[model samples]
Target: MDLDHTGVSADELRRLLRELSGDLLSRRRFVRTYVEMWPTRLSRLVAAIDDDDLDETKVVLLSIRSSSVMLGVTGLAHLATQGLHALERHDLIECRHVRDLLAESGDRACERLLELEATESMLGR
Candidate 1:
């Protein structure tokens, strides 16, 4: 449950499970879906920034930030927020840096989530 290095909060994940009626199946499914979509989301985000599509970048960033917060992916949420701020300031350079960080963080988060899911399954949680 010490998932600090993963940038995910176990307590927050539990809170989300509770909010989802405490359904273990639902929790697993949600985690799976989030992990599965991360690559595409990251791609779109990078593409938007590369294209200099400010509106698309904002949309993608907000989407990432909101969903990350909901799923307790605190690191990703924080990075997305920073990306938003950079966008707001018209700092494309900073936004690019954040995008790189996001890629790394997103990969780590997905790996951790998958490990957590496997652990939960093995323990029948």
Candidate 2:
């Protein structure tokens, strides 16, 4: 059999998200759930794009875009917006450009997420 993941299929991702989010609404909803995990998700997406896994990158990028807006993160939305265009239409080389745009931002996002998670723990939220 030729096993393949053409990209992070929304269905498979949705199943995983339900496990994490404790809800089962739709694939879009699953993606939106990552709004709270944007830092981790964006880092993974950028890495996936660098590895030339556009599909996986797309899923994470999609999550970031949707989640960013939903979570009131407009400044970070550009990263996902650029990633989406690259994933949907650009070739690997061009896609790398989009990934490059996000590289530093992803790093910052990770740091922010870490700090917030720690604060949340301290506050018992």
Candidate 3:
């Protein structure tokens, strides 16, 4: 899939995994782990935002952004980065916008990850 249309650099993800791990099984396992934790992370992010906790929000956003970069989840990373910038500027409204975008993108990414899991299973991976 050309995920670039959705602003995701799939090639970067593939390259990073190949460079860092060079093992398909390990990479797949990481993907599964990431998919499993994604929702909980999102919920925590929302809670931090709702509580107006800038410190917590920065921590969570940085974690998510760094992990997303490793996973080649560029859209999520971008959203988190935007949120961080908004937080730095004390723009709560922009932070909310970024949060919404992150949620929407994360949901779609989750669906795609599930599909990838199914395909991998079918391929005996």
Candidate 4:
């Protein structure tokens, strides 16, 4: 999917928000909750990677990918998918490459999410 300069799929976000009845309050609540929990999820991911446990990594990535897709964090979802594919192929090197890319993409996605939250607050969304 084409993403905005923020490296996030704003269109997807807009679509989902519309589906949520355009409820800014709900959106804010959900976003806040996800943001609060993301660090723990990320820590689990790092631990999985450190252990070089492919199964654990795959499980974590799957969870992350699904959550990201639901929340329109396409860059992160895509990176996670790439990692999964690498793992499926048993390409540890490629998996590591995608892991770095996932880290960068996830950082960008989180920054964009914060920016979105700030924009919403500023606009009284």
Candidate 5:
């Protein structure tokens, strides 16, 4: 499968579908859940950062990075990884910058995933 310009990897999504025994319904459900939780995740990440809670910030960044990697959200994953590195260096400024980037990229990624899902369903993929 070709990679999407939306920063989502169609190949990885297909792999996930294959892991679910090619069950489209399951894939759709998972995607929906992921999309729905995105805002909450972002909110939690912001809260953690604003509170200067390093541990919480680390947990949130790791969660975002791991989940994004699995979901083929490469841009968001990269930003999350950057946030983690910034956190490790105790660079709040860099961490804040990455957090902003994540907010933008993550939203775009989720929107693209939804669009992809709709297109796939319409095309009977």
Candidate 6:
């Protein structure tokens, strides 16, 4: 939230988050769900890049960045922000931070998923 550069409304953002939380825990709960969604969304972002869909790619990246911030993955958020900036500027991008973060997140998520997947695989033996 680049308040210094971009004039984003603090009140409006608070209101938006407030409005979204319902039927259970709170807005904070939804942030967790958002965090879980990030890894999967990266796949679509990469696909859009491969397809040369710059506009959609940019939009997706920006949304992913925002999700990263809202979800409190600071490293992930930095990566996403770097990617978004590169796409926005239409310049050659070598976001090592973003690459590394994505790799770390994917590796971590895959490890967890595989562990769970194997739990069933080894069950009842």
**Model 2 C-alpha lDDT versus the unseen true structure:** 0.54
lDDT score, candidate 3, position 86 = 97
lDDT of 6 by residue, 26-94 (tens): 443544465467566777777777676777777777876676555334445566677777766764345
RMSD of each: 3.6, 12.1, 4.0, 3.5, 3.9, 11.2
Please identify model 2 stretches exceeding 4 Å from their true place.
1-36, 107-125
Candidate 2 Cα RMSD (Å): 12.1
Of 5 and 6, the candidate ahead on TM-score is: 5
Q: lDDT of candidate 6?
A: 0.52
Which sections of candidate 6 miss by over 4 Å?
Answer: 1-24, 92-101, 106-125
Best by lDDT: 1
Q: Tell me the tens digit of each residue's lDDT in model 4 across 3-121.
A: 43225665666666777787777777766766676677677777787789988989888987887887777777887888899889888788777776665556567778767766755
Q: Say which prediction, candidate 4 or candidate 6, comes out ahead on TM-score.
A: 4
Runs in model 5 with CA error above 4 Å? 1-6, 123-125
- TM-score versus the correct structure, for each prediction: 0.88, 0.50, 0.81, 0.79, 0.88, 0.55
How far off is residue 36 in model 1, in Å?
0.8
Better of 3 and 4 by TM-score: 3
lDDT (C-alpha, whole model) for all candidates: 0.83, 0.54, 0.75, 0.73, 0.82, 0.52
Tell me the tens digit of each residue's lDDT in model 3 across 51-123: 9999988998998889787876777887888899999999988988878777778877766655654564455
Two-way lDDT contest, 2 vs 3, winner: 3
The lowest-lDDT stretch of 10 consecutive residues in candidate 4 is: 2-11
Clashing pairs in 6: none
Please, what are the lDDT tens digits per residue for candidate 2 over residues 1-125?
A: 83121112223333443555633344334344443465577578767876877678778777766755443344456656766776667666766765665555554543443444334335433
Which 10 residues in a row give candidate 3 its minimum summed lDDT? 1-10
